[model samples]
Target: MNYDIFNGDADGIISLLQLRLANPVESKLVTGVKRDIGLLGKLTEKVGLSKTDKITVLDISMEKNQTGLVKVLDAGVDVFYADHHRAGEIPTSKHLDAHIDLDADTCTALIIDKLLDGQFHYWAITAAYGDNLIAKGDKLSNLAGLSVELSEQLKELGTLINYNGYGAIVEDLHFHPAVLYTALLKYASPFDVIADNSSPFYRLQNAYQEDMASALAIKPDHQSDKLSIFELPNEPWARRISGVYGNQLANQNPKSAHAVLTENRDGTYTVSLRAPLSNKQGAGDICSQFETGGGRAAAAGINALSKEQIGDFIKAVEAFY
Candidate 1:
């Protein structure tokens, strides 16, 4: 059997979309909420693997899934892995094909775009937008000769799709990432998804507006010249909008680092950290200092940050840039 394991966010979902659209496949889908990066482990825990099984893993950090990956490879399962996150040490195995690029500007979908020679270029561009590589998305769209209006449409679609991926759990999301992927597979191009009024694009748009409105109503928990911090309550909407809200804040205040912290049920905070748009270099480094943190230079996140360390996190960001 073929198993498709991917991150539930826009980058991972759209990366697999481009590949499947180019080369149709029958595979068991494996995905979860946006923060559920330990996907290979879930697959191993849920079902036994076989020597004949083939797996495609996307977006999630290889280092996080290293143990599960080794197990699959030892069982003779062929794996195709692609991502932009930190990969500690890549395994050397004929059964594994890994395409990993740590460039801050690149994403998995864009990596697949180059591999497929841009067979699904528009989708890749949309994924770039969804991943918040805004400038890169616009540049690619222009190079593709897309009209400004069409490019805007792609951006909105990407943003909405990305928004749907957030949530403490899949149940909090309007559509599970696997279901969203299935729904999107029917459309040959992203434009078609936008053209279809019944597509998840429309549903996500409505849901996104509601969540963003609630988030916007909350005042920043802490604010200063160097950084700003917003603490969201432990609600489904808060979890759904934390990452996107952080992005919005960073864009609104280009010179200031921003952190959006969502209260978890356990009293810890799920933090989304964005370095100043004017200086997008230290976010990942700053976040990596925390035990539960790791991400790219432009944007990073901490899975669970202690309430006490909140002050320290703010100071670290301020000191970095």
Candidate 2:
């Protein structure tokens, strides 16, 4: 059996989408909420795992899944990994084909785009937008001769898909990531999704507007020249909107870093950190200072940050910028 293990976010979904579109495949999908990077472990426990199995991992960090990766490779399963996150040390196994580019301007889909020689460049551009690579997406759109209106449509589609991945779990989301990915797979182009009012694109677009409206109404919990932080109450809406809210804030003030903290059930906070757009560096490093924190340079996150560490997290961001 072939297993498609990917991050639940837009980049992860689109990376796999491009691959499957180019070379159709039937594989079991493994994914979860955007923060659920510890996915390979789930596959390791599969009962029928054997040498004939193949695995393709996208967007999630190789560093975070090292143990499961080693276990699977040792079991003789061939694995292909593509990501733009902070990969600590890639495993040197013949069974592993790892494509890791930690460039702030790139995402997993873009790496696959290059690998496929841009066979599905439009979908790659949408993933870039969803990953919050605005300038990169805009540049690519121009290179593709996309009208401003068309680019905006792709941007909104990407943002909506990205926003849908933010919930604490699948139930908090409007559609499970796997379901959403399956629905989207039928469309060869993002424009088709936008044109079909019955598509998930419209459903997510409507939901995104409502949640973003609520987020925009709230003021920052802490604001400084270098950093801005917002603390959200423990609610499903808060969880769904946190990550995309951080991206919106970063775009609003490109010079200041942004952090959106959603209160968790266990009296902790789930942090979505975005580095200053002008200086897209140090986000992953600053978040890495805390436990349960990891991501790419431009954007990173903490799954659960205790109240006591909030001040320190702020100070670290301020110091870095």
Candidate 3:
């Protein structure tokens, strides 16, 4: 059996899209909402334990999935892993093929683009945009000789795909990540998805606009020179828009860090933290201070944060920036 596990967001989906497009494969797709990154352990729970099974992991943090990865390797399964998040300690195993780059400017799709020799460069660029690496995406677009209008089109497409991924669970999402990935796999280029009005791109675009409008109406709960925090009520729309809204806030004020927190059912909060665009560092470190927080430096998130710890999170962001 072959399993493909990836993050549901733009970077993860597009990374796998580029790889499968370059090297066709029949595999079991494993994914969930954008926050669901601990995936390898789920694969290990599968019924069969076979040394011949192959697995490909993308976008999720190796540090978080280390236990499952080690277990899989010990079982003699062959694995290919690629990501840009913090990797605690890469295991020494011939069964593992890991490609990890923690540079804030690069995303997993771009890393795959290098591996595939840019066979799917446009899709990779779209992922970069969706991943909030706006400047990097623009640089790659210019190198590819894309017109400004075409670049904007890809940006919107990427943003919409990314917006679809931000939900508390698959039920909260506009479309399950696996279904979205399968729909996108039909198109070799991201532009093709834009041209096809019937594609998931259109559905997500409409949904994103509605959700974003609701988010835009809400003012920041806390604003400071170094950080701005917005709190949203516990609603599906809030859950769906939190992450992308954090990106929009960061883009609006390049010098100020931004946090979008949505109330969870347990009276806790789901937090999406974006480092200042001008200084893309320490986001992961700040979030990692929390029990349920971990991600890349440019953008990190906490699955659940207590209402009491809200002040501490803000203080940490302020002290760092």
Candidate 4:
């Protein structure tokens, strides 16, 4: 069996999309909500591995999935992995092929674009936009000779696809990432999706506008010279929009770190932390202080943070910058 496992966000989805478009294949799609990085283990638990099984993993942290990766390799499975997150120590095994880059401006899709020599260049640019690497996306778009209007269309498409991945669970999302991916696979090009009136692009665009409006109406729960914090209710829309809202906040105030905390039903919080855009450093370090926290330097997250530690989290971000 062939397994195609990826992050549910734009980078992961688009990364896999480009590869599959370049070389169409038959594989079992494995993905989840944006925060579900521990996916390899889930696959291992549900489907016992075999010596001939082939796996492709994208966008998730190799460090977090190392255990499952080792297990699969031990079982003689072949694996291909690519990502831009912090990889503690890569395993040396003939069965594994890994591509990882820690550059702040690069994403998995961009990495795959380099590998494919820009065969699906526009999709990679869209993924960069969705991942909030705004400057990188714009530069790539310009180099591709895309007009300003077309660039905006790709930007919106990328942003909407990215926003769809933020939910706490599949139920919280407008469309499951798997369904979205399958629907997107029909289009040979990103522009084709935009041209088709029945495409998911329209549905996601409308949903994003409604959710973002609600988020914009709220005042920051905490604000200081170096940091700003916003608390969102426990609704599905809040869970779906938290990450993008944090990105918006970071872009709005490039010098100040921002936190978007969505209340969980269990009296905890789901935290999305973005370091200052002006100094994209220390966010991963600060988030790592919590047991449920981990991410890249510019953007990190805490899966479920206790209410009592909210103040401590703010202090850490404030002190870091």
Candidate 5:
């Protein structure tokens, strides 16, 4: 059996594309939403333990899936693991062929594309843009001869796909990410899909842009040099647009830190924190002060913050900056 598994976001899709371009084959594909990075263990547990079985894993790094990776490789399964995430300590092995790089400027998709000798540079460009590595994105874009407008379109699509994966459950999203991935599977680029006007990507793009407009209007309650806290009132669009709202805020206020608080269905709030992208340190630490949140130093997330404690959280965030 040959298995193809990926992250289920733009990066994952692009990584899979690069692999297919380089070594096209018919394989059993295992995938889920962007948050399903830890699903590798379940796959290993269920799949038959056969030495001849083969697997290709991308985007999600070995460090993130250490135990499961070890189990599958120990079974004598031939595996190719390619990823770009913070890996503290990667195990050394022979069955497991690992291609891992944790550079903020490079994502897994681009890594695979490079490994494949730029067979899927266009897709790699989109994945890099989606991961917010514009310099890398442009490098691939220039090499692929992609138009500026087309690059922006893919960037838009990538951001939308990434944002849709934010909520704790699929129910919180405007569309299930699995369904969205399926819709995108047939198309090579977002520009090709949206160019026709009647395509589903166009409709989704319009909906996402409108929701973004609504979400961006709210003013931050406490704005300072180091921090800004923008609160979203209880509403469907607000919840749906929370991540994009955070991205937009982070862009406009590039030098300052931002905390995006969206009221949950239960009356509490979910917070997304981004320290200055230029100085992305300690953001994950600051968000960990709250419950259910951890990320890199520049960006972090919190599942639920009590409505009453909103003020105190803002104070801590300001102090952290």
Candidate 6:
């Protein structure tokens, strides 16, 4: 048995799409929600790798999944990992091959496409757009045969799908991202998703638009010259829409950094930060002040914050700006 382990988001799906196109492997897909990574162990349980069984781990990292990865390699599985996450202390297993670049500009999907000489460039662009690599997506879009208008629409789909995968759980989203990925898995190009009338990708796109409209009903927290923080209550709609809301706020008002927080079901919160595209990038620094997260200049996330720290995060953002 062969396995394709992925992150269950745009990058992961598109990464697998690119690899499958190049290698044409009919492997079993092992994926879950965005947070359900470290999949190598799960695959190990399914098929304790013989010399014939193989695994492709996409958009997940040795850093985040070190323990699980070690278990899989120790079990004699042949695993290939492609990721863009920060990694440390490279493993010495002969059965493991890694393609990890923490470059903010290139995601895993794009990396695999590059490895395959861009055989499936459209999916690469979709993954880039979904990851909110806006400038990179624009360039990739131009190369992928999208007219300007269609390119923007596909970008919307990517952003929407990425945004929905956010939230603490599936109940927070209009649709589970696993379901969305199932809808998208058959297509080689995102355009194929839009072009196929029978495809549910368009339906997912429409649902996201409606949900984004609902999330935007709230106003900015404080619209300073440098930052805009939008707070979302612990509601399903708000959680479904937080990531897109953050990106929308950042894109529509590029001069200001944006923080979009969704209060979680447990009364904590998850934050999506899209810092100003300018030079004053302090997102990772601020997020590291708490126990929750660390990310790049333009985009980042904080997984969970205690109720008390919620106030501190708000106060810290003021200092960050």
Pairs with backbone N, CA or C atoms under 3 Å apart (clashes), candidate 4: none
lDDT of 6 by residue, 57-101 (tens): 888756667877887777777889898865666688998998888
Cα error of candidate 5 at position 248, Å? 1.7
The runs of at least 3 residues in candidate 2 whose Cα sits more than 4 Å from the true structure, single-residue gaps closed, are none
Q: Which is the winner by lDDT between candidate 4 and candidate 6?
A: 4
lDDT of 1 by residue, 1-321 (tens): 999998888898999999999889899999998889899988998889899899999999898899999999988899999999878899999999999998888899999999999999999999998888888999999999999999999998888888888888898888999999999999989999988998888888988999999999999889999999999999999999988888888889999999999999899999999888888787878988999998888889999999999889988988888
Better of 1 and 3 by TM-score: 3
TM-score against native, each model:
0.97, 0.99, 0.99, 0.99, 0.81, 0.87
Winner of 5 and 6 under TM-score? 6
Q: After superposition, how far is residue 252 of candidate 5 from its true place, in Å?
A: 1.3
The lDDT values for all models are 0.91, 0.93, 0.94, 0.93, 0.71, 0.74
Per-residue lDDT tens digits for candidate 5, residues 1-321, read 888888766688668776765666877777664546676786877877588788888877455578888888777788898876655577677887888775556778888877877765666777777666655676767666777877777777667666666554666665665466556656665566666676556666777888878876787787889888888877766766776577677777778988888887787887878777677677756776776555545566677788788777778778877
In model 4, the runs with Cα more than 4 Å from the true position are none
lDDT of 2 by residue, 220-314 (tens): 89999999999998989999999999999999999999999999999999999999999999999999999999998999999999999999998
Q: Distance (Å) between predicted and true CA of 319, model 2? A: 1.3
lDDT of 3 by residue, 1-321 (tens): 889999999999999999999888899999999999989988787646589899999999999999999999999999999999999999999999999999999999999999999999999999999999999989999999999999998899889888889888889998899999999999999999988989998888888999999999999999999999999999999999999999999999999999999999999999999999999999999999999999999999998999899999999999999
* Stronger candidate by lDDT (2 vs 6): 2
Model 6, residue 268: C-alpha shift (Å): 0.4
Lowest lDDT 10-residue stretch of candidate 1: 276-285
Model 2: how far residue 46 lies from native, Å: 3.5
Please identify model 6 stretches exceeding 4 Å from their true place. 41-52, 143-145, 171-179, 280-289, 294-297, 314-321
Clashes of each: 0, 0, 0, 0, 0, 0
TM-score (C-alpha) between model 2 and the true structure: 0.99
In angstroms, give how far residue 285 of model 3 lies from its true place.
Answer: 0.5
